[model samples]
Target: MMALYNGDEKDIREFFRVYCNFFKEQGYDVVTFEACIGMIMPGAGALGDSRVIPVIQEEDDFRNYPWDDIPELYFKEYSKYFRALREEMPEGMKAIGGVGNGIFECVQDLTSFQGLCYIAADDEELYHNLFKK
Candidate 1:
């Protein structure tokens, strides 16, 4: 995942410039630059080294997810970043929308893989509602 360290447009631009230049210098033909806002989750836990534990442990937590309330603001911020990234894209490089995990994948990320399966089978309403959000 790409992160804007300073959350500044200039830094964002410079990041892409340096990234694309590095690839160009390596003689690789880069064609597209993709961006995404990433998944929204309550919190995360670190497992031994490279794994994470999702913070949403129960149905109530999923139902009360804060992102459900102010998605418009999130989209607005995402658009601003998209526009800035697009402007900084290397000439001739096409801008592509990054792939986002689907609802099922999101549920798995918010909860655990086993928890997601159990919830979907045991509480159909909650399962559907989680995705609706």
Candidate 2:
């Protein structure tokens, strides 16, 4: 997986610059997401701007990408990503998902407040359609 490094913090243009600078400062080779994006598209406006260029061609793994299937591929993709991130963490950050991290809260993020409530209220039809399932 690739990560966007925006300076020492999170800013757009500074990202590429910092990456290149990092290579020069360290006097070592570095593989950057910019290069990946460039290989993906030379004129990509931004890494996250999917409208213009796709950073990850795996649409099934994308969060907002709509699908005709009820169980979107993103659910599995995100679950794997989440589990991997959790498992790979260094001791201090290790923790298990509980109460606040349950399916309802996550579904709420996919569906807005009212949408989530409506779904939880047993309106499966409305919930399915509203969430693009």
**Lowest summed-lDDT stretch of 10 residues in model 1?**
41-50
Cα lDDT of model 1 by residue, 60-104, tens digit: 877566775445644655655566656666676655545344556
CA lDDT, every model vs. true structure: 0.58, 0.36
Candidate 1, pairs of clashing residues:
none
Clash pairs for candidate 2: none
**How many pairs of residues in model 1 come into backbone collision?**
0
Write candidate 2's Cα lDDT for 37-107 as tens digits: 12222222222332443322222323343434423443432344343333333333323432223333333
How accurate locally is residue 83 in candidate 2, as Cα lDDT from 0 to 100? Answer: 38
Task: Report RMSD for candidate 1.
Answer: 4.4
**Against the true structure, what is every candidate's RMSD?**
4.4, 13.9
List candidate 1 stretches off by more than 4 Å: 1-8, 20-40, 44-58, 69-81, 90-93
Candidate 2 local Cα displacement, residue 109, angstroms: 0.8
